[model samples]
Target: MLKNKFFLIVAILLVFFVVYYTFFGGNTASVDGLEATINPATYGRQVVEKRTEKDQFLRTNAESPILDKASFRGLSYFAPDVSYRVVARLEPFADKTQKLVVSMSDGSEEVYEKFAHAVFSLHGEACRLLVVKLENTYSILFRDSTSGKETYGGGRYIELDPKQLTDNHAIIDFNTAYNPYCAYNPRYACPLPPTENKLPVAIKSGEKYIAHE
Candidate 1:
């Protein structure tokens, strides 16, 4: 009888440890908490759920690409006349030069003109810089940055779409930046932002990195 009781006690303890480790004892929980605090609208519960859904979609879907080809056939707008520069290199994870492109936009009719080059840190990893001009807007894609640490590791992406690109004006807002689908799941191969796209300053805007359960 005593032996049976002892075995039962051991089993109970094992179950408790498993529960703790699976839920509250890992980095997953911490990431969940961060997502909750950042997403005030859903009150945090939906953050994990949304991430899960995105992961599932990326894993099962096969048509998504790292960078979607831009359609600028009908776009006609002069470049913006904005003067902005990267004040710092928050983190670098690529081999190419970092740059900042500012658009001259006044709320309506944005335009992307020139890009200012800057230095970046590779964060002990190697990456490449890809510059693609689509339609009337320009895209800078690269990998390796504070994105995984402060943002998403799969890398964050910023674009100056036609709507935001106007004559001598562009709407460059970090808050509007977002993570690619690959950030949620490893199955997806989203394009990493180029080193040139890395901003020297901390863009405290846009979506924050999320942790999956």
Candidate 2:
């Protein structure tokens, strides 16, 4: 009977820990668990932590996109700014079965399901972007005025966690946008951003690239 009670107590503690972390974890990326009172300093630190982890992975991971790992000096990124983190209202597509075919870097095409339209305002300008289900998670493929100047001309992607969606709203943080693998290696066949995803504004956040030949 003592053993049975101990097992029951352990199970209860495990459940409590799971519930507590799900609601109070300091996961900056997860809008669902992110604290509402997070300040810029804390958010910036969390973003830095994520970037550091990515750098470590790219430097040591065998599957890294960098061909010459010896010369990789880590990726460049704009300063973390909370201003770029905006809450967007997701509008579901009327035709849920809609599929979008996008051109690939290697002269091919890939099909993705139209997820929703993320409507938000950035820098006092109202903007809307098409979100698509690219494999497992929803992603936004976009090209801004910074393309070809400060960022990759082929565009960048911002992946959205399905768990981050709360009441048809999601936090879209441009600071986390990243270049496609093709930016590092031409051998990669990355999907290009559709024309509709192009933005007139210059997004100064996210990753930057300079071709090294």
Candidate 3:
């Protein structure tokens, strides 16, 4: 009788595991791979706070990219939308030693390694972007359909925190995208987005272009 009860308990546990995996594990693409829980409200609030701090820095900091501090108006931006935050599957390049030469706005060129490809979906469209190792973190230099019309003409950049990335996935938050320093001052040599990194969709989130005085 005891042996039969043990087998019955094991079968019940197996059924529970299957049901849980079917409902929850299938959603791995939506949540941060390292973090199981995602709070949209809190994430939106953090994005706002960071943007506010950036505006303050641009307005007052001595090393700010804005050349005319006195007449400098705050930077423009799209409203924070949590939907722009996406979880991307990171696929490392087969040839890790490959180098990508990118042109700069100042006529110079910068070299970057072809680190990985970040694949994700946004606005019901499949997207893939080239990732590169920039200093200690990873960065994506990209131009979207909004370029030259709604955002900066040259391009915009998004830097991923190395700590936030897992082996196979990372968070690609378009809400944190920003124009390069060259957009504000031509004195700075900023790297332009490569042809492969140009996205076909209109990314309506992140910073917008404001005519500087």
- Point to the candidate with the largest TM-score: 3
The residue pairs in collision within model 2 are: none
Ranking by TM-score: 3, 2, 1
Model 3 misplacement above 4 A: 1-32
Q: Rate the local accuracy (lDDT) of all candidates.
A: 0.42, 0.85, 0.86
RMSD of each: 17.1, 8.5, 6.4
Best-performing candidate as measured by lDDT: 3
Candidate 2: regions farther than 4 A off: 1-37
TM-score-better candidate, 1 vs 3: 3
TM-score of each: 0.37, 0.81, 0.82
In the range 1-213, model 3's lDDT, one tens digit per residue, is 999999999999999999876665544544444553356666678889999899889999988989888987688999988888888899998887988898998899999888899999988999999999856768999999999999998999999977669778988889999999888887899999988888879999999998674
Give per-residue CA lDDT, model 1, range 145-177, as digits (tens). 456566775555556444544333333333335
Q: Residue 110 in model 1: shift from native, Å?
A: 26
Alpha-carbon lDDT of model 3? 0.86
Clash pairs detected, candidate 3: none
